[model samples]
Target: MKNEDQAAMLLLGVGGGGCRLAASVRAVYGAGLHAVGVDTDALANRNAAAGGMTCLLLGGSRLSGHGTGGDAIQGRLAAQDDMQNLQAQMNGVRTAVVMACLGGGTGGGSTPEIVKALGEMGIATVCFVTMPFGFEGQARRKEAERVLPMIEESADSLVVVPLDDLLKDAGEDLMLENAVNIAEGIIAAGITLLWRLLSKPGFISLDAEKLHTMVMRGGNALFGCGSAAGDDRAIKSVAALRGCSLLRSGEALKRANALMLGILAGSDLRLAEVGEVMCEVNKSCKPGCHVEMGTVFDPAYEGRIELVALAFESWTAAVMAVPKSETEVAAEPPVADVIPARVGGRKVRSKGGSKLSFGATGRGKFKGVEPTLYNNQDLDVPTFIRRGIRLER
Candidate 1:
């Protein structure tokens, strides 16, 4: 079938982690949500089936569902061998929202390949991934970081939430399982807000077309959702989101070039409160960001307000070739081509080994140009570096 004839938003779960996250999203979204969970683990796929996802067990010849045993390369190969099978399932998908927890073998390996396949078929994709927790060991962390750019390469935009940061506010008394569940809820909520903003109109409408424009313009991105009840709900929700470890609150929120802010509240929502929240969030962004805002009023949120913020760096245009609308082309700012800096004309730059302030440059390469040496193993670097793609200002 031709690309234009096939159309639907596919929520694809890549591996065990991805599939698990996908399942959670499917539960909240309920019926009418097109969701598929693909994995190399037969057991995991079975579990996903129990949760109402169409589970696709990939690469029968390679692994036979025993699992990847933490080998991402084998996971990648399995997905590659089963590309036709994966493509068969994507016949009508115009856009795909990929969910996965990175760092493990299956998710780390198969996600990029799946994303590449979608993009090649002219289907735009937005990826939401979770990095490993600090306690998950440096090996997993390294793997997650290594595959990041590869994921970014294939998807139109990427939203990465560090697991460790997501768990920062949870006290030591919180059980491990509960913490993990809460993290899942946060991710599910964030994407749910975006989906609602696009699919369901509110008092201040943010339609699907405008959303795709923002998502396509976004490169690497950050996502977070926070809610508060009772007094000062609006300000408190935005403040909570700003202080969220998952948001890297200060860093990611401040550096985003394009941002979509969604406010969900009850009919009792105050106009002044909305203004205060937007003002506070705008204060966090670099000056003159392209901010798309909307509000959804629900009786369910009588005394509560929730905030979902998705922010992107300028690099989102790196791989995306979509043509900007006439208005977009005409409204280009003076510093659009240059790497974005924080307000006050301050260029955030890291030298030697410190973390830089600029979002486009990324966390930092290392002490020098050397590949990161973790536990005596040399990590695989992105092609941009090997090809000497100019990354910094």
Candidate 2:
């Protein structure tokens, strides 16, 4: 990749697990990768820094270099306190890939806040978060679930990786530590494929601009990869991808609105193999689903083929709004004719000129207090009443 392209992108790691994941990706990606890690634990921050990532300590004064100790509230507060420091690292970045593991304090609590802040800065964010394993207990799982919506609200594209599903594909007989490492390795390798697709020389390139556009319109995404060698390597790799739990056994592809497929193989890759891979993938997806494919050739991948895919479930078209002509505007239909109103548990046709308004309703107990205004709307009033929605009897 060009220096300008590298400068425009950032790989951000949040909390300890996130930092480790980022470090792993960096190791695979080699040099010229812009990376940073943030955590409430000073020791963890130092460790990430030791791995060549720029580290920032969150809640330094309040937490006193100690971690949140599983308290998500503290993690949230720490992020709030050091948010300015984090922003300082985002000097020239236009896109960020965030890595965080939910169910813990720093990852769960701070991720939403960080993503929100990045959005406000006009930076597009793609967040990859792992849900805790079931054995981790209900509390952690609940915490992760609660934090998910918050992160989704701010992230341009959200990819949720459930550790349980990830580990299930690995094997049942592995040790705990080894299983965790392998899971991380798998995720890191997938991310590395994406980076390589952008950075490495390719027969067909997937540029950063294409990624930015797709991500901005792609809401929720699914990422998975598979590799195979020897005869029919391309077809076999795609078959393995079909069985990947991360993609819900190829169900994600069937339901996807858009797909970004990357193929990495050696110079010996055949044109027929590429055609076959595309043919099989096209058959799996719905008609007219937006698809982008790129291929990279590397000598190291001789006799092997690896496929990485990102499926976007909620992809929207980038249609530009065209101003209506004066004649067309004059012939516009009435709002009542276009939008049906729901009344008495059913849709009802209303007269075109009928106006619906809700006057100020008296507050129950705090009637005399100043109204709580949000965006110039009174928050003190009932939401439905404020919006002039007629409730069913």
Q: How does each model score on TM-score?
A: 0.77, 0.80
The models' CA-based lDDT, in order, is 0.73, 0.78
Alpha-carbon runs more than 4 Å astray in model 2:
198-201, 205-208, 298-300, 319-393
Find the candidate with the highest lDDT and give its number.
2
lDDT of 1 by residue, 171-249 (tens): 6787889989988887877776676675564676555576765665356677777788887777788888888776786
Tens-place lDDT per residue, model 2, 1-393, is 678888778999999899899999898777689999999999999999999999999999989989888888999999999999999999989878999999889998889889888876767788999999999999999999999988887786788989988877777798999988988888887777776665453676556456555655467788888789998777788898888888999999898878888887889899999998888888878888777788877677789988889898766332111334545443323335222221101111122334444346635332443333323333345556545678899
Q: How many residue pairs of model 2 clash at the backbone?
A: 0
lDDT of 1 at 145: 91
